[model samples]
Target: MPDYQIRTLDDADIAAADALFLGTLHLPPTAAEQLDNLRPSYVPGRALGAFDGDELVGTAMSYPSALAVPGGAVPRMGAVSRIGVRADHTRRGILTALQRRQLSSLVEQGDVIATLRASEATIYGRFGYGVAERVRSITVNPSTAEIRPDLPRVGRTRLIDAAEAETLLPALYEQIGLRRPGMMTRPAGLWGIWRVRETKLDGLARTAVHTNADGVADGFVTYRAVKSGGFRAELRVEDLHGATPTAIRELWRFLIGLDLTAVIKAGSQPLDDPLEWSLVDRRAVGVDGVTDSTWLRLLDVSAALAARSYGDAEPVVIELVDDLLPANTGRYRVGADGARRTEATADLVMGVAALGALYLGDVAPSTLAENGLITWSGEPGQAALGRADRLFRTPTPPYCGTFF
Candidate 1:
């Protein structure tokens, strides 16, 4: 018999769930502050608990959100977060059961996809989640970094207080539409936690805004400084948003120009951020880290495939092997126009996990084929794979700025 049962979390279960999640991470709750900051964001019916009779052994939840895809398509997605299972319950089927319940619920609610930031690299692939986005950690030496002369700037910058930042940043994020794939809408509750509850400033991180000649805000950056050594400090950026390329350039220039700060470091930067290219010495900016950021699982494969626009290429039929969602186990023809179910023989075959990775256009077909993740059917299969690559190519790599 299964040792635990999975069900929707209730109000009474909140404390236990929070305790389990925080305890597993070894963080104690604040004495003066409760999880009141998280209460407002608690999505009713979206959280699930796995219980060993009266005891809660595991927890997981998802916030309803939309994920921006290539060609300006935004699909309804469930942002999976706040997941934890008690250490003692390790290797039990509890986690698998909870995941199955949540993912199934997401599909029933018509969610096209589910995305999560995996705590470990090894856990999610078995559940059909594939690495769909990447983030880079960058360190820039401000003294040696100079903006290239040819890079034009149209905006001036000014500092702002945290109060002003909380009021203005979200609006600017909305104004800067999700032009790139992998970006998602930051819901209001998350904004509250990010600006007020989290960060070193304790809700008062130093903020700066970029403004055009007319004095309209186009970009903003939130960062804090820490003394690293004698006469030197590190400016750690919390978040940076730009409405345009000029805005991005201006904000970056301002951050690197801060006095007393010898180095500026930021995590979760888009892999394609042009900060290095715009600098006089590209070597001044070092990629200190790189890692997979978002893992995506397609719940409704047909709708997921049709939601995003593709590149100009001939339609290619590929057979999918989906054990979790058996309905997706079939052949589909995909092209620049869109994707559709097809009865024709598939030229290529792959598991759903591999398909999710290819969905973002970040993983090339050639790479997948070389890695043995893809199987070719005929002599013409190689050409079909080529066509698939063209259709999935994106001008920019996919990146999700939101952490959850």
Candidate 2:
């Protein structure tokens, strides 16, 4: 094992961290240039790098943000991004050391939880990060899809230029509120990257705003069109947000009404999209795929458990094993009242990472138990697991619309 020191990143280290991050993915420098243009989200004294005698081999960056959980409580969370290890440093324990240092720093800084979008599914479990949220992609044949008359359509949508969108969208998102459990408040750096500087979406995408009956901007969808042939066109959605059910319906109406567009594709949509039910022909909406989005790690187990609301079920004692953050290893009694450390024997045993996976109510405890990710103290523990599942379940499956 190489002796490497993990420390906070500074202004002088940005270029080096960016280079190694891009280099690890085998991407060109153009990507780094694109990253440079966006406002840096790195929190001072939180961005960490593992250096082997001053040569940077690994980097992980974090920023402060509030993560919305059940019962409408938003807790301060650490949002980690651009985590990577130099190609040659793989399997050498450098990644582990960097994560440990980052998690430790977050705990000291009073962050209750840490979250990241994992590039690979298998990479972060050992570090106590769990898949806390999921998103799905949908393909709609717009020409055949029809909105049912019963669904209220009180809003009128109109196209807006990029500059106008830049001014309105951020405020619209705030007005709409981060109402979902897994949703987050987007920082200025992320908004600048997505709405202002056209990187992945590029400059071709157009923004459409939905106005209420009183002519107020409430929802918007950013999408782009591509002509594949003389008669065929496709509309790809870049981003979409709605403040109300009527706003959502109106926005979809506008998207489907666009002429020459046969196929409409959108990703990162909530699992319970009303567009499916709004259609006259339900089969027109095809679910292309679903993938994990937000990976959460509870930096402070006691605080994390107490932050979110639970169901009106009987309390259950859980024994959590945290390999990286050993201080979190203990039994906790969690229920509708809130969670607290308890000296009683645990009804269930799970890894800290597994607990994080269930923190946002994305996956149920019973489901994890069926998959052997959880261990019960008794043979027929279905009742206890059922109660725990209800306590952790949310009205909608957790979905994080914000990328960072």
Candidate 3:
């Protein structure tokens, strides 16, 4: 038998769990004051700890939230975070146990999906988590970049103090709603941590709200200006969202117009960000990097498949292999109409991780098949793959701007 016992953590165990999690990352211990501020974000019984005898050796926790899928379906999801195994307990099956328990709890609690920002790309795939969304880090030379004259400017942006930002930003975000697939509704628990980070941890971060001619708030951005060297200041955009393209353009105009700013940088931006095209010189904006943003796991296969809308394509049967959750290992026929379980022969075969990747409509089935992540079970494999690709295709690429 294993030495560690997995159990639900209580409020009193929050500090130890947090410390253990931080220690695994080689970070400093959490300050008493900061821990107190973040305590409420840790919901009671949401955290799970692996105890060896009486010491906490592993930790994993998630916050309640909802994810927006294609066709405007918002299903319950768990925003998983703080997953770590103590140094001494590395590769001892502690983390796997914690994940098993956590995933089971999420399923039992009726969360249709679970999402997490993976610290390492390679760690979560074995646990059935797939890279569902990708984001780009961009650096724009504001001095050389100029907004195109053809783009309409119909909004004004105003800077707000931290106090006002604390109150207005959340409401503004809700008003804008989730316009893209993979976007999630932030709960108060998650917002509490974000608030502390922006307001308390980052002193340089500032907020700006955009309003149209009607004087109604429609968009917002939070950024910080940091001195890189002599006479050069880099404006790092932390969060930016807009209800309309005009509002986004105006916000960019304001940032570009900031005096004495040398460069503007933003991470976790959507792959299809319009800022580049809006610029008079498209090359003025450089791609710094592209990285995975959201690792998604579909806790319920049938429900998740039916949740998102599909494109017009012939029906294709897909056999999903889910080892951890055996109940999901079955054949499912997916088409534009909807998804349902069927005993028909599967044309395409893939694991649950590949399904998660395909579910967001971010990556195409043929692409996954080409990459050897998927295999064919029936004849005319290319045709079946093409059908699957068209069936899961989305107009806009999936993007999850929220970082948890």
Candidate 4:
């Protein structure tokens, strides 16, 4: 066995981490820029490389993200992605040391949770992470699809040039990410997503804007058109947000009713999204299936609690202990604002990674307690813990738009 040491990556490691990431997947180091776009929260120091003497053999990267839940907003969820160990380093406890080191660092900083887009579903479970939501999809006929069967709504659909996307799209994603779950921040290069796929970026792709009483751009959808016997579309909703129903409906209708051939494909939707219901014919909607995109692992419980906004309610204290990710061992008193008010007088501790999943969405505390991942001090305390979680519940299960 070669000598090994785990250390926080610095500027020098960017080259090595990029090399390992690219080589394992057989891409050039240029992918570092692309993957960097996916990781808006990456700090070189926060990303780690497991080294064997002079060679970079493995890596584990995490970043800041958010989860959309019912009633209110939560902030700063840590999403773990791009975790890999070169084949040569496998089964040697390299992964174990890397995670242990990362968890220890996160615990010291006081962050409660973390998430990931798992490459192998089976691998992360042993670390105490679990799937919290399923990202579902829909395929539609574009020829038959139209924003409105007849004319336009209060909003308008325009074939804006790609250059305009830099200004228009990011504003729209802000609203969507704030109100929705399992959504992560978009990278700077996202503005180029259209052109890489098409030359004009407007042939099949376009933006539909919904404006409110004040005439502010509220929500938008981006899609590609395919004309067959009828038109077929694979629509990806970049972001949809607004203050009123008309604004939201207008954007939804614009995409679904676009002038096309027959079908449309849309994915990464929230479970309770109203788009399907807005259609007069419910049968027109079809669900491909629900699947998980974001898998969570808790880094630190206290910082995780205090990072985002929560709903209004009385405060509750709960103790937490961890197994698989041992660094996150502590008791926490969570507040109505979703803030951490105090360290628990004692540690309602569960596995660190399981807490990360629960933070990503709603994984009931009692079920885990029953499963023996946690020990509830009392039924009332357990009930309080469950109800306390109401703040992080999502209108839809968390869904990531792209694979990490």
What is the C-alpha lDDT profile of model 3 across 1-404, one tens digit per residue? 28899998988898899889879988766667776657866877678999999999999999988999988999999989999999988998898999999999999999999999988888999999998899999998988899988876776899999889878887888899998998998777776677645544432778899999999998999989888568767899988888887888898898888888888999989988988889889998999999999899999999999898889999999989999988999999998899999999889989999999878888999999989899995557778999999999999889878998
Per-model C-alpha lDDT, please?
0.83, 0.84, 0.88, 0.60
Q: Which of the numbered candidates is closest to the native, going by highest lDDT?
A: 3
**lDDT per residue (tens digit) for residues 237-323 in model 2:** 878888877787888888988887879998889888878888899998999999998999999999989989998899998999998
Residue 95, candidate 1: how far off, in angstroms?
1.2
Which pairs clash (backbone N, Cα, C closer than 3 Å) in model 3?
none
Error of 4 at 13 (Å): 5.0
| lDDT minimum window of 10 residues, candidate 4 | 193-202
Ten residues in sequence with the least summed lDDT for candidate 3: 195-204
- Please tell me which model should have the higher lDDT, number 2 or number 4: 2
Q: How large is the C-alpha RMSD of every model relative to the true structure?
A: 2.0, 2.2, 1.6, 5.1
List model 4 lDDT by residue over 12-85, tens digit each: 56656756765666554544445444343346556888888878899887654454433444544555655778
Roughly what TM-score does model 4 have, to 2 decimal places? Answer: 0.73
- List the candidate numbers ranked by TM-score, top first: 3, 1, 2, 4
TM-score of each: 0.94, 0.93, 0.96, 0.73
Whose TM-score is greatest here?
3
Off by over 4 Å in 3: 199-203, 229-231
